[model samples]
Target: MQNKIESLYKETLKIRLFEENLIKLFSDGKITGTTHTCIGQESNAVGIASLLKKDDCILSNHRCHGHFLAHTNQYVGLLKEILGEEDGVCSGIGGSQHLFYQKIFYSNGILGGNMPMATGLSFANKMKKNNKLVCLFIGDGSFGEGNIYESLNFISVFKLPILIVVEDNGIAQTTETKNTIANKIEKITASFKIETSILNYPDAYDIYTKSKKIINKARKGYAQIIVIKSARIGPHSKGDDTRSIKQLNLIKKKDPLIKIKKKIKSKEKIKKINLDVINEINKIFNFKSQSYSNRKVSLQNKKNLILIDNPLKTFDGKRFGELINHFFHIIAKKNKKILFFGEDIVDPYGGAFKITKNLKNLYKNQVFSTPISESTIVGMSSGLAIEGYRPIVEIMFGDFLSLAFDQILNNLSKFYYMYNQSITLPLIIRTPMGGGRGYGPTHSQSLEKFFYGMHGINIYSLNPFFPLEKIYEEAFQNINPNLIIENKIQYNFILDDLNNSKYKSLNTKNDIKNFITNMSLSNYEDDCRTIICHGGASSAVINFAYDDFIETENSSRIIILSKLNTLNIEEIKKNISDKGPIIITEESYKSFGLGSEIITTLIEDEKFKGRNYMRISSKEGVIPSSKSKEEDFLLSAKTINKKVYNND
Candidate 1:
């Protein structure tokens, strides 16, 4: 008991002294970005850290210095991170607010943002049947966030092994929590049927003792919450103190460090521990000064970075929607690790478009119907993927994908690079795109172009030649986050071979073709125009202009692209004839769209420098609900025919 108490005191003191030094450093202009100090609330983090096993995962909020210290105990590395040195934890890309270390510990600046990630980690734990728990630490300020509630509801329904620790310090930067929070934490969590506990004291030992039982329950498939009533002695960050002097004084009186010091009784031991902590901190400064010059070269080396390249597979014929369902059924049967999550994706409803019809009934344990929480759906799936499960999440529409953009951008796309590529996130985000459905501006949008250049993420579109089942198989095997863009208009189209004497197919059944790049030539004697299209636009162009290419004396070529990002520009350049005018068509907007990228690539190449290029895309406006207007809004073969024959 004495040893445990002494260790708790040491941990709390280390966090306190680390922050105190950081406060001085920030004042001295040594640290760059704003730092959220957890000076008075050290017990909350320390208490949670006590019950955590080495393999247990933890996600933290903006005020995360203490949590990082508690889990890692690498003061020097953390100090370097806050100082933004190249030798820092995340290679200086993630500053004090964002820190990822040891693969299991992650901290972000966004409030309540990591909740879904924690829930995902727990979901992974549940799927693997691993007796491990995921702990999430958030401030009272995060209670108002809708994602937190969504995460809580998910955790409750799934019965995931997760522990949520809310450190209620009564204040959020400058505003009181009571003013912002609608209902009490206990009552709100209880409504979800989650087991909740509130710790009103500010003592480390007290916290440690109370948290063990809750954590144990959590590890055994019980999602629980522990609200620690803490006080903030320091301001939220440097130069941001709004609390009165009296309030600060009262907070200092109940400081966890002070309360723990009273129990120690050995002044000599306390003095020695404080001296050791100071020396440890001093070592950080010495190391920082010595390694400052070499840090940049070390960062540039880029160790542990992973690259994904998967080959495309060919399928003969099938309807787009039915093919997708068949692909899902095959992958679900083959890989037990593949889990499907989406809205209305059960047996009867079979997703918004019936792409996942009967998947839930077949794979009862693996397939699940998620609530209308797009952010949580993506975030939690990311967590599940991180823990070695292949999670395929479906967004009802491409437009709603914006709601989950933060998780897709920050967590899913960046986790591999941010963590030095030590982790593989095998997550597939499948959503239907395009504007021919007459569902109006919000529902019918060809938004795949918006996510084109995201680092560490792969994007694919369904094409007529490539097998959808094989695409899913290759996606699962590659171990990267993939975005499969399904066009709404192509859902009912019959995918079959385009056999013509003039046009030669670039892809063969057994040949090694680029994942999504397919090309065919139209033998015309005079014209040398090359048409590049993808997804819905490809179907439109083929339907409208197939006969024009065969009959005309002017020969042209069509290139079908399914993979938008990491395109094979060299391969694409090889197919085009010398000095041919290129026309790139897309269902998305013209500005900053896929067509723009293709044009830029063509212009940059020395071979295609003098070639005439044009882009055929939808006008930069919303797609109306009327069927006729929607048809006019999207790029079609008639537009291509006019561009080619009439030169309109």
Candidate 2:
């Protein structure tokens, strides 16, 4: 018993000394980004962390230095990481907040964002039946975020094996916790029907003993929350403290190190332990290390998805939704890592646009209906992907994607690179976007333009004219996040309607995968025009080209690009081989959209420098619902003609 107290104090003091060194480094401007250190609250990190097995996952928030050191003890790596050194853990990409260490430890700076992700990690462990639990450290300030509650609801409902450690330090950064939260943190957690415990003492042994019991309970399929009422002795980051002098004095008295030190009688042993910890920390500073960057992550316990070379012959007048279902089945058969998540994406209801219809029936263990919490649903994808499950989530409508924007931007886009290429996110968000259906203003908008230049992910626009199976097949191999935008009105259209119907055009294979060109049957005359568009505007552009050719004997080359953000300049130029007037059309508004990007790039190309290019877009005011102005909102044959001929 005496040895345990001394040992715990030694570990806790190691963290304290390490954090003190980091503060010195930050003061010297050696650290690149902001940092949050757990000074007085080290006991919570050490106590709960001591109970965790090596395989048990640990995720932390901004104030994570103690939690990270307590679990991994990679002091030098943590210091180098904060210094932005290439040889550091996460290759210096994630810095102090966003971190991943061999899949055992993960952290992010976002206050409430990590909640759902850690829930996903627990879910993955449950699926694998690995008997492993995940511990997530969150501050009291996290209660202010809605997604935290969403994550709590998820873990509790699923009976996931997760231990949420709340380091309730009385104050949230500068503001007192009482001023922000209406109800007590325990009451809110209890509302979710989760088992909750609270402790106000800083005894490391006491915390470790209690945490072990609760963690065992969690592993047996019970979600738990341990609230450690601790104190913050240091500034939130670097010199940001606004606490009163009395408050600071009081916090010092509650310091776990100080409390536990009083229990030790041998002053020499305590002094030796503290000196040894500092020496170990100092030696790690000189340790040589190599850099680890983004590399191809192997599929977890599953063979890589192989692409069959057989030509797709099934697009013989099949419904768009059925074709989507067929494609999803093919993906499911090829990749075991693929899991489907969305609201009402079960057997009978399928999905909002019937894209996932009968998917659950086909892949019973892979399909799940998520709560209407978009952020948490997306956050789950982030965690599952990092843990080696490629989750395909449906966003019901593209408009609601805004609700999960933080997750998409911060979690999905940042995880791969931030973790120094240690992980791959085969996370795909498939959603229907467009204004053709009268679903109202909120549901009928194309928001893909908003995510155009996000570095780590690719966006694909599904066209009825293109093969659906081929797109998913390519996306599966990419091993990154893919946002597929499907046009709602085209869901009922016959597959390959471009060649089978009255639209008689030539299909030219392009360099980019699934990106094709439809050339008018008329000869490529000198006066031909080039039309750049996607699925939503493909039919309208083709019909307009047919009539324009008939009237003026001028043929049109229509380039339909599925890869929205990643434009192949050379392939695009090949399709626009003839020096003709260029026209870009989009179902979305014109300003700062895909059409603008296309036109802007086309004009910059040396081959089309002197060319006349115009962009046709839907009416701005009619977006979302605008039922009375549906014609104006949709990019139709009339809308295209008015924009093309009116100016000419």
Candidate 3:
């Protein structure tokens, strides 16, 4: 056991040396991107990871080379990834900061982002009754985020089989631990009433011993937290002052490697250990150098590509309630994995909006009624997705989305990319948005704007004139994690042309192509005023010019942007120049909203010199319930016309 412990310590030391060489590679411009090194904090990562089973899930922070080395021997994948080789873990898309492996929940760049994610993973493991534990390695600094406390509190309440390993390295980058963390981290677990343990660092055997017991307990039926007091010998990053000369000298004195080395008795035994470790390093270095030849590895293929193109073309001219009833009718016949979950959504009563009208009769086990926990709704949906199930989670109203923001931001949005696209989070979080039915501020809102800029999420927010079959197909695509924000106003809306199935005659792919092409060909001039908009009121600007635009010809020339994120630069350049001014209108608030992004981009574009830009958005406040109140505060065609016409 002592010899095995010494071997593990040498493995960790190799990782330290590997990172040091990687830093040199970064300095010499051999590496393209950034990395977070763990030079002194190896003992905690190596010790805890050594106890994990082969199938156990591991989540780690940005400082993850230690985690990668500790979890699996995919060293070639790790090196190729850092070097931006196509054969890399993320196919060179995600760099050193992101090392995702499907076999293990490998890495993340966001601080404290994986806490809730690991919680969701544990939930999935428990639901399957799979006797496996989910482990999360977090830094002392990440514990400062509010989401961490929320995740811990929820994990304890649920008694999920999760092991939270807090790597207490005594510094938040250059800031001392005292400045950031007010209370000791180990004590915080008690406030949540969780089982906790403090481990001695620089002892692989000790960590492995304690972790084995804890892992067994968690796997059976409990949650645990392990706190390890580790050191940060290296800089916070390659060029950081945290690894300065003074710090370097201090690190050498406290080297955990020296401590482990002195314990070994036979000189001949030590020589054999060094040779074995050196051979392992040579294999990794050689494998990484040769990994780029024929790398055609893609974990997720375009599963439903044709289906996304040729959506189901059927929409009965029924009321909104009837259409949703029909929608559920078809969903019941599809597959078992497609599940419906929400507060009021059950078998007979259907859903709060009667959207899930008769799912119980056909697929009784699929439909489930969950507690009124909105966070759990989103979080559990993520877990279900990870377990290879498709979940259509309904939050009763758009306002309730705020309650699930942590789950949405932390797990739902990031799972696919964070795991290097190995996992397909084919989830649809449905909610009724917009205001009119007088449900007050706590029930009605169009909140897709909140998720617009988040790194990993794709927003498919639209105000379809009515129920479009193509929308359902887009929502079910396996490659995309979708947020379908349905407008309450258009819930029961019926398009006359669509009712005749005229859309069915047109090729679904052609329709999208024609729409995008025609939108690009729309008439506009450099001397005219350009207005861009989306969601509910976008059509008003397209078919009918704003009421106040009572006079300007430029009002007719406003180019409507359908794809929210990928704004058409060609169309903008053609229509917006030095002679023209621009205005962006949306139903979301101005701060961190779509309108602000457009205006900022336009003003900064040098080609559009002397162009005046403005954003017509919600008057920085919550969504009001009354039509009259919302109309007074939010941007509508009338308000947009007034703002632009008034400015002109």
Candidate 4:
């Protein structure tokens, strides 16, 4: 035990020296950008490292250099990463704050952003029965994030194996936690009813003894939290700390490295470790690993299946929602790793729309319906994806997507690039939108516009008039997050029921991604007006055009955009050039949706600028609960005709 403490002291001293050199390097301008060093908190990281197993996962926040150095000992890789060199870990894309190593150490820059994902890694370990636990290192300031509480509840309720380490330095970016956090962090974790421990100014050996028990307890099936009152002897970031000199001196006095050194009797061992750590820092400038660069993402799918098969070739009079629900069974039956997550998504109630009806009963182990924690749902999906699980999350309603938007933007959408392409975020967020149902403002909304600008995610609106091409299969292989928007009223419409003499779904030879690209109804005519929309909107346009309500020809062409973001610009232009007047219709708000984005891009060309076109959408007002008022507030074929001819 004496030798163990001496060994731990050397490790702690090494971490301390490494971070101090990093600070010195920053001052000398050798490292560009910013870095958060764990100068005084070296012992806490070393403690966590001592208990780490080969398969155990460790997630750290911004001040991660110490944890990474103590855990990985890849000082050269870390330094090269900070220098943005090609040979650094993660190919130099993830600098100091963000890192990935051996699929074990994950460090994110966002505050509390990785907690939910940590739960996911724990969930994966538990599901696989690997007996591996996750060590998530967060700050006391992270309690301010609601998802942290959500993650705690998830970890506790599910009993996942995770040792949550709260390295409470008492400050978040210069503001003390007392000023920002109203409740004690321990009390909050205690509320989850999980095992908890708190340590104040503990030395490395003390933390090691306590953490080993904590890690072992958590590995046995219970999730736990350890709040270590560590100190930040250095600035939050270079030159960013606001602590006074007197306060800093007090924090330094409690430094664990100093305490551990006093407890060690052997001076020669300490000198050797210090010399070794310093020598490594000196050689870091000349280190080489792998040429690193940020991963570039393209919306285009690399696999263009020529003979793509569509299982749902023709619906047998089943409603649109029921048909999709059947496909859910098919997808789940095919992939055992495919997981379903949502509120009320299990058997009995199924989903709010019944798309997930009977899924839980069939795959009890895979399907999970939980409390109204949308952020946790997305975050867990991200974590599960990282652990090699294909997760499909339902957002109950598309309007509620805003609740999970931060994780979608930060974790799911950014992790692929942030991790330098070492991992893929293959999760699906399926939800119903539009004002047809009386779900009011909070529930019934066409919120696709909010997801338009978020990169690294695919947006697809299902069209009953067309075949549901292998979207689920592609979603897993596409190496990105997918959002499938469903319309409530459209769910009742039978598949391919809209196909008639006027217009029918077509698979043109111009498809780039499987067959969904040009898989919409088209009548090749350069004279008739080309009305355009997607998903449910296509049925309304076909109904009006086929019934001769406005006496439009059968070949009057309609392009139902299945994939909204990556538009086939050439195909659209080729179909619309010198053709009938362009009429763009969207089921959502009056401005800035699929229709607006398409028309806005097309108008830039001379061929479209002079064309007579009309943009039809839901009028700007509250989507009322009444059926008649809801129809009046949203876009339909009648509304499109009214807007087009009434002004004329």
lDDT of each: 0.78, 0.80, 0.68, 0.78
Span of ten consecutive residues with least summed lDDT in model 1: 303-312
Residue 60 lDDT, candidate 3, scale 0-100: 86
For residues 257-362, write the lDDT of model 2, one tens digit per residue.
7888888889998998888988877766555543333232444544356474323554343677677777777667766778999999997888877878887988
Best by TM-score: 2
All-Cα superposition RMSD per candidate: 4.0, 2.7, 6.8, 3.3
- The TM-score of predicted model 4 comes to 0.92
Residue 507 lDDT in model 1?
29
Top-lDDT structure, candidate number: 2
What does candidate 1's lDDT look like per residue over 208-264, in tens digits? Answer: 887788889999999889988898889888879988888889888889888888888
Model 4: per-residue Cα lDDT over 144-184, one tens digit each: 98989888888888889899889988988889899999888
Question: Alpha carbon lDDT of residue 293, candidate 1?
Answer: 24
**Deviation in angstroms for 142 in model 3?**
0.8
- Candidate 3, residues 1-648, lDDT tens digits: the string is 767767777777778777777788889998876888888777777787788887888888889888887787667788888887777877776688666776475567778766756776786787678888888889999878766876787677667888888888778788877688889888887899888888755556567766788878878768988888777877788777645687678656766666677667777777887887777777776664464432333645645432322112465545554565566667656666677777778767777677776777667777766656677667667666776667888888877889888777766776676556666777778887766566767666678787777666555544443224455565566555666666666565554434443232212111342112112112323225556666565544543353323344333344444344335455555544334466677766667777777667665777665667777766677767777886777656666666766842
- Candidate 2: 10-residue stretch with minimal lDDT: 289-298
Ranking by lDDT: 2, 1, 4, 3
Assess candidate 2 and give its lDDT.
0.80
What TM-score should be assigned to candidate 2? 0.94
